[model samples]
Target: MLKIRLKRAGQKKKPFYKIVLMKSLSKREGKHIIEFGYYNPLKKFAYINKLLVYKYLNHGCYPTNTVRHLLYRLTQNKINVK
Candidate 1:
């Protein structure tokens, strides 16, 4: 199972995260299949690769709760409902 989750980085007290694609059994901060985006909690910033995200999601890659919420906001106005 592949997952979209945060990889911890940055210095102490100033947290930054890499939104990555990796296997479920792999170490949390270890190897990643791909890096699709970035999030800086302290700065309240997010940057994502929509095409990559869509491709992964279609392949059954599930994002962490925080990433899911961010994706929801980013795609809200652009997504169409039938």
Candidate 2:
């Protein structure tokens, strides 16, 4: 299964995350199929690729809980909820 998730990066105590597309069984920081965007927790900022995210979401690519929450917050105005 393919997953849209976050890969931790940046220095200790000051973390950033890369939104990545990877196989579900792979290591969290392992090779990824693609990088979608960035999330900076400290800055409370996120950069996302909406097109790719929507494509994957429609094709059954699941997002991690954290990623899903972030997307919900960011794209609430654009996405239709059932």
- Per TM-score, the best of the predicted structures is 2
Question: Per-candidate TM vs. native?
Answer: 0.87, 0.89
Model 1: runs farther than 4 Å from truth? 77-82
Runs with alpha carbons beyond 4 Å of true place in candidate 2: 77-82
What are the Cα lDDT values of the candidates? 0.84, 0.89
| Model 2 poorest ten-residue lDDT run | 73-82
Give a tens-digit lDDT track for model 2, residues 24-44. 999988999989999999999
Native-referenced Cα lDDT, model 2? 0.89
Q: Which pairs clash inside model 1? A: none
Which 10-residue window in model 1 sums to the lowest lDDT? 73-82
User: Which candidate tops lDDT?
Assistant: 2
